[model samples]
Structures are given as C-alpha cells and as structure tokens.
Target: MIWKEARNLYVNKWILFEAIEAYSEDGKRIVKDLSVINAYDDGKEALKEYREKHKKDKSREMYVYHTKNDELIIEERMWMGVRKNG
Candidate 1:
C-alpha cells in the first residue's frame, strides 16, 4: 500500500528512491518518483507518504529493488584475449 524506498546502484553509487504505480492522464502505466527521505533510505517514512498520496488507487503497485554496489556477473568470453595466462 505504501511506496517503499527502492534502492539501486549505478556507477558504484547507491541510488535510493521510491516509486508508486500510477496511470498517466492517458491511462499509461507509470511510476511516480518520490524524494529520497534518508541518505541510504530505510523506507519507513517514505512509505508513509506514498500511501497517503495514492490511497485511493488500490490497483497501484509499489516495487523496491535492492542493490549494493551491484555485483556484476562476468563471463570469461567477455574478456576476449586480454586475460593473462595462468
């Protein structure tokens, strides 16, 4: 019901944010951006405000995707011929 603080990482930086499912004027699915409440965003206070804002929209969905420095899964083929021989 409430917009939880959603966090993601980009370029090794933590990007804390929140989103509430909303339909644009033309009825297009969209996510409304809420300001970052805390530095790392604990999602406590922000969720409260988001619920209050779109209380009537029962169909709306709040999504939170957690990321930390972002772990990258790399394959050996990606490195091509630059890898050192062991």
Candidate 2:
C-alpha cells in the first residue's frame, strides 16, 4: 500500500495515512484505510517525510488530507442485498 499523511487543523496534528481496496461496482469511491503510521506536531515536517516515502513507492495509492481530526473518521454503513445462502 502507499503511504500518506493527514493534518488536524484545530489541534495541529499530523498523521500518516493510507487507503485499502474495498468492493465497488459503479464509478463511486468506496471504503478506504486511514491507518496511522505516526503523528507529528509539525505538518510541514510530517509532509516532508511523507513525500520521501511516497517517492520511494510511486505505484501505490496515497493521499494527504487536512481535516478536523488527525486520523480518518470512518463511518459504517449497511449494505442491502438479496439474500444469504447456507
């Protein structure tokens, strides 16, 4: 997986981030992973390190997000289906 980072605007916190593949049918972006590798007080420094790691693996998916929380806020949703088989 790719390496990424996110910053908390209010608290001024930086965190490493990544996204994982999830099932999808249409052109809509689905589930993702916000795994926190580490946290930093300086956003610039955190981003600098994140860039270096990203450069190493350019083939993986990564993102840098600035949100209220340093980590990603995951929301659970129920999927509707036809039935369950034994």
Candidate 3:
C-alpha cells in the first residue's frame, strides 16, 4: 500500500513496513509501494522488531515510522568509513 493509505488505516500508531518499491531523491527515500508488517503502540517496540527483522534478512528494505507524520521524509546518508573503537 501507499504511504497515504497506510496513514489512513493506521492512525496515531507506529507501523513497521517493508518498502517493496522505492527510490532515493534529493537525499530522501521515497517509498512508492510498501507492505505493512505490523502496527505498534510504541516507537521503541517498532524499532526493536525492525532491528530483528533487518538482522535476519539484511536484503529487505524495512522501516519503522509513526502515522502522525504527513509524509515519509527519510533523510538519506552516506557512510564514508568504518568506525574503530580505541
């Protein structure tokens, strides 16, 4: 489903979804098509679930977001190098 449709369906809730079709534009991720995995009352819970799922299958594009936002404005970042602990 689209972001608008998902927002309508799950109001004032945290949703964990997988981006089926998406693209990066202007340093932001624009999800064109998505599938809702689950809905949660808390953002932390949604994030925890997202982490687990992501760890299991790194290939899948998943995100946790609240429905209160009008649009999905995910900022894209580029990681330059690996972090080293001293």
Candidate 4:
C-alpha cells in the first residue's frame, strides 16, 4: 500500500517492513512498487520484535518509520546498480 493509505490505516504507529517487488532483466529490483512485509505498532515491544527479525536476516530491506511521516516514507528509495565500463 502507498504511504498515504498506510498512514490513514496505521496512525500513531511504526511500520517495519521489507518490500516485495519485481526484478528487472539485469537483476535489479524495481522499488517503485513495494508491498510491506511486517507492520507493527511503534513501541518498545515492536522494537524488540524488529531487532529479532533484523538479526535473522540482515539482507532484508527494513525500515522503521512513523505513519505521520507519510511524505518521507513515500519518497524513500534504495538505489542499487553497478556502473558499466565504457
């Protein structure tokens, strides 16, 4: 879901997630279309849960952000690519 939708749904909460996306032919994932993995309340308990989950798989793209910051969340992106030799 988009951050705006998520914000309306999860007010005063923190969301932790890894995006579900499609990969390109060159093996790069397209992040514009992302599905949230884990959604948790923003609290000490949630922090503990995030820590445990993050430790198990460090490669997972995880983020802890508040619903209030919808703009920031929506704009966030991870750039991944290697420059080709000329």
Segments of candidate 4 deviating more than 4 angstroms: 21-31, 37-41, 73-86
Predictions ranked by lDDT, top down? 3, 4, 2, 1
State the lDDT at 11 in candidate 4.
78
Q: Provide TM-scores for the models.
A: 0.27, 0.48, 0.91, 0.56
Tens digits of per-residue lDDT, candidate 2, 1-86, equal 31223343234555555656643445443435446555676778768877997999977544444445533444445779899799
Q: Is candidate 2 or candidate 3 better by lDDT?
A: 3
Candidate 1, poorest ten consecutive residues by summed lDDT: 69-78
Q: Which prediction has the highest lDDT against the true structure?
A: 3
The parts of candidate 3 lying over 4 Å away from their true place are 83-86
TM-score of candidate 3 against the unseen true structure: 0.91
- Each candidate's lDDT (Cα)? 0.38, 0.54, 0.95, 0.62
The true-versus-predicted C-alpha distance at residue 30 of model 1, in Å, is: 16
Which prediction has more favorable TM-score, 2 or 4?
A: 4
Q: How far is candidate 3 from the true structure (C-alpha RMSD, Å)?
A: 1.8
lDDT of 3 by residue, 1-86 (tens): 99999999999999999999999999999999999999999999999999999999999999999999999888988989989999
Tens-digit per-residue lDDT, 24-59, candidate 4: 444444344444555676466566777898899888
Error of 4 at 17 (Å): 1.7
Candidate 1 residue-wise lDDT, 1-86, digit = tens: 22332334222223333443344443343445544333324445445655664476655443323334232211222234675689
The runs of at least 3 residues in candidate 1 whose Cα sits more than 4 Å from the true structure, single-residue gaps closed, are: 1-40, 69-86
* Winner of 1 and 4 under TM-score: 4
